[model samples]
Target: MHPLPAILIDGLRATLFRHPRVSATTVGAGMFVAVVVVYLFASILLEMAGTSPPWMLLPGGVLTVLGDSMLTLIAAWLLAVLAARREAVWGIATVLLAATVAAAVVVHWPLGELASYLVLHEHAGLAILVELVARCWWFFVLLVFAHWLAPRGLGHALGSAVLAYAVSAAAWWWLPQSPLVRTMPVVQATAEPTSGDQDGDAKTATEQDEADDDDAPGAKSEFDAEAAMYAQPALLDAALARLKPQTPGKVDLYVVAFAGDAQQDVFRNEAEYVETLFAQRFGAAGRTVVLENNAATVTTRPLASWTNLQRTLATIARTMDPAEDVLLLYFTTHGSDDHQLLVDLDPLPLNQIGPDDIADALKTTPAMRWKVIVVNACYSGGFVDALRDDSTMVMTSARADRTSFGCGADSDITYFGKAFLAEALNRTTSLREAFDLARTSVDAWETADQKDAKPDAKGVAGVEPIQHSEPQIATSASIEAKLAAWRRTLHESAAVPFAPAGEAMSRGASPSPDASTRSGKG
Candidate 1:
């Protein structure tokens, strides 16, 4: 063979037979197969339901296959982007996936329903295949896209796609069914009444009479009156007595209470107590911005939104030195695994305000010399983990595995809030001291009551306590002085310099001492 032809052949072999490229192509092909399987299975289910016309089903199948292919492609693109550390591409792919899923769910409701029913019927062969396809197709798509787009060529794409597929499959298999699915209605046959039911009816009537007695006016009045007494101003006063310092305005305080939902009344009672405590000790006059029973306001608006509470904090920060010693944050609400401080709205993703995100936000805010964030909620300790910073002190009502407790149509203030307010009102204890005491007491209560329900009570007990993790009150003076000096330097450096003669005039420079001296002489 000629030398040039032999060289060309060798180069072609090296390029075409590369492991990475072959792997990527293989993964992409696999994803295509998976998607085709899902579509066919879904189509068969729809046909069985008699809802799909043969001709219409064909087009539906095509669209489903096409949609799945796009999803796979997008997934492959994402995998590749992630592998290459291409943030923009990854973000775009994520958003695209979310949008596509949302749209497909809306557009193919009937198809999903049919597929769901088929799976529910426990058709092992069809269900297993469909699930496998649904789970694996996205990985292949991502691999193919990555291979096409990634700078490292096919190998990187293939590796990433395979990894993503494994992860998706594992998650799909392990994840619990959605709440809706778990609560699905089971059909049952109705039974006819018999003559023997008369005895049962007589007993029911007697039970109803007893229930009415339990709900009589006197009994209801006594319960309501006692609840009102517990929620009275005196209880708040006691709470403040515990939380208050000897000097007023010595510490800046922020209280965020999320009530409403089905648990408004309970929360309302707690809110009232907390407010009263602050009022008595801190002089409720200007210290508090109570978000009274407003779960919607807290959850719906982003933290950056111009909520009344946010506005108040901004004003306070503006008025005080950025480095002033101040206790900055207090939050009481429901929390979820996703790290969302859930209130009235559905749980938000924890990623939205992860500990790192909270740290970043606090770093920029100039108002507080020291930041103290207290979260009273189920799984609230997770917030502490996310919000911890050199400048922050964190406290949570419960650990990540536990639930905060209280009952009253979900309206009563939670046990965590109640304990917290009680300690705060004492006035002798500092914020740090109060949080420690609260955590200890709450944990003890949860442990004692829920010992048998260990898993269920995982988060009920607050754990991993840290006292004065950031700048404590003792070091506040020195930190404040240093901050002041830095601020002065910043201001001095930022001052515009004076220029001379025509140069100064043209540039609109302010007059300097030297210029004034020369002008006076002239």
Candidate 2:
């Protein structure tokens, strides 16, 4: 062999075997460098494809990386202590730095793929288990390393691994808090006006919506004043008084657009579309009522608030025949980790709605026999445990621990809303069927989005699986039968055509005189 080749082979052998003359520091530094090189290469490759690195989170991505590195160092130190190793602090630090970089590189691709898979499927528990395996792979390596360095007994390795995991998990849960402020990319509106009746009644509704948009400029300045009026007790009472049930029907949907500050436009638009869709399909003209919180795109509408919601339910309950009619309530808003639905409208802070609040409202409405509730927000699955009963069917956008996606100022609807309301409902009349289709669509979209945004080479890193947002549904045993019956009656009514509910087309003008009168009688 050539002299240069022989020298390189000897050097590698010494480094791998931890030769007496070669300090642990030198070996650790080399490993650390190797990890950094891998991470940088992955980042560069991703960037070249017009994709941002997985660490580009809001508030401070650099800080998050630093936090991860710190956890690695702590774990390494714990392992050293458990193994009775007296390695230099600097050598240990270098080893940890290498471990952190290696872990980041090792974890990304799998995480992204798992996230994509989660979006397509409903097996969140399994996905999370796999993710834990990926995340803790470094610890597994560290265990073997502890034995290699110190030749300690199996007990030492196991103890070190257990302690390292406990400490690292605690630190991860508590540290690395990031603020929620991110720049939203603008997306052009893709939804078009819906098609309607032969007499052009649908055209009238579409034109009215367009007219409302055209009138936005004048209404912008008056938003504050109008918002204040909505806040007043007297104005709210008057609006509530004006609300009467329309003709008796098997089903009624009461929409509450819980406007939170995070993405006012997205929440508002989705809520409006859902109300219109439900009204048109389930005999909404007189039977459906919407209480909005934000000025949204249509400034002419009134803002809905917590107080307004309670009152609306009360009024609806008084007018509705509890035993014969069904109530479908849709809540669209932002959510917090504490499982509270955030209600916002700057200059006027509102209370967050918890599962208790929803339960209380329902309890007050003793007359509404059957209930179908849809919660569109992050951490909304927390509501299912409290709201689901023998007569109620509760559906949520995400699990209690996960955050749902697509609630941005530039977007029109959330992932859940788009899948369930806008798309699935258009294709099916059954709520159960709509939910199934929507969930599947959401999963495909999420998986595809991650794949398109982040393509990997040699599968080093995949897209960041920042959110799981596992949607959930809990239907009461007998509620399905009732819902089926309601659907039958709903379609038999001839008030509205089986048009795609809430398509961009005209929804027509206000409620007709006949609808209003029937509402009054109820």
Candidate 3:
């Protein structure tokens, strides 16, 4: 056998509690170089072995191995201190380094893949069992290594092994998020037409999406934002053109829903839900325009922007009798402490909307008389002052000085979006009543989250906890009466059930709205 292979075989045997001929004096700086080479090979292999193809390789994956190496060195030093053998630290480090790599390749990738496959196949119970077994086996490997190296006792060796595993895990979990170290490459794969479709008659997935109905919630397709940005004007025009011309003498309702933050899918989900909810339940079919800043909808829906909002408001004013039709303006996104809506989609230069801009836009469009603007964002109460008027009703998610919860990648909808748009609005037509119910629901959720929140290591001892976001509302008697008259015109109907984009779009079985959203966390 080759010398390197022979050394690795001994190291693997040592991890399994088998004795080897390896000596403490023979382990030296050469072992460190071997460890580095092995780690690089293993990480590169793991990177290419993801469930999804075209996986981006993170170069800073080396940081993980470096962290593990340092932790192993520390553990060996601690064990040497306990055994009163300063000279034996290098030997212990050498063996433990090789054992850790063996554990990584044996336990992490192979067993982890089995557990993930079980999970993907909907065998979550089996997956959990496999994960538990994998963890036990990994710990056993480390414990065996420590027991052989520490002369003091099993107790001291156990502590050293625990420290090694804990520090290694912390490094693995947190280092990926470090912007300074990780340089992730974007993997874009190009595929040529196959022999069966050499004539180019087959449609690409994107072309198929465009050929399908945009109203279908399940017809989501991804596109390059920067390249497709020029299509925004035409997309907006097409959406507006689909609207049924306003019938004379009927108290019509026109909806302009804006989801301004593309970073969180929660905003996009909320916007999609609102579009379906208004069209199906609120008697606004062919009269709603949804502007979203999401990656999935960039090609299908008009990108949410300051310019688009102006065009939409102007077009709606021209379509409806400004004095008679009711307009509901819905805005969902992150807010700055200074009160600006975060309008963004990467590589697209979009401007953020402020309270003054909103007020000014509506102010210039003199024909939009009865207005109800809903702002679902942190620190949105600041908009109330600028938006309040006799003909406009302003509803905000949080106080000017406070923050709102439930807006992130994990959440399907914001706390306010779920309570107001999904639950309360479904049950009641009265805006005031819906706001009241939603406020109660939001308060309950925020309170529960507060109690469950754990103070992390970085938390200051005396710092005050985040307070409850008090949802604010400014109503107009005139607009309420107009809305009430429109409510009287609607045919009596059952409450529309809420669903997120995936589930709701799947069956297409409901007589009601099909956009379904998940619960909690923005």
| The best candidate in terms of lDDT | 3
**Greater-TM-score candidate between 1 and 3:** 3
lDDT of 1 by residue, 163-270 (tens): 655443333333221110001111112223222121111111123123223332212222233333234233323222233222333433444333322123344445
**Clash count for each candidate, listed in order shown:** 37, 17, 7
> What does candidate 1 score in Cα RMSD to the true structure?
24.5
In the range 246-320, model 2's lDDT, one tens digit per residue, is 446444544444444322456666666766677677665545555555543223344555556666676676666
- Per-prediction CA RMSD (Å): 24.5, 21.0, 25.3
* TM-scores of all predicted structures: 0.35, 0.50, 0.54
Tens-digit lDDT track for model 3 on 232-260?
76787778777777878898999989998
- Please list the residue runs of candidate 3 whose C-alpha ends up more than 4 Å from where it truly belongs after superposition: 1-222, 364-366, 455-464, 509-522
lDDT-better candidate, 1 vs 3: 3
Worst 10-residue stretch by lDDT in candidate 3?
A: 513-522
Better of 2 and 3 by lDDT: 3
Q: Where's the lowest-lDDT run of ten residues in candidate 1? A: 513-522
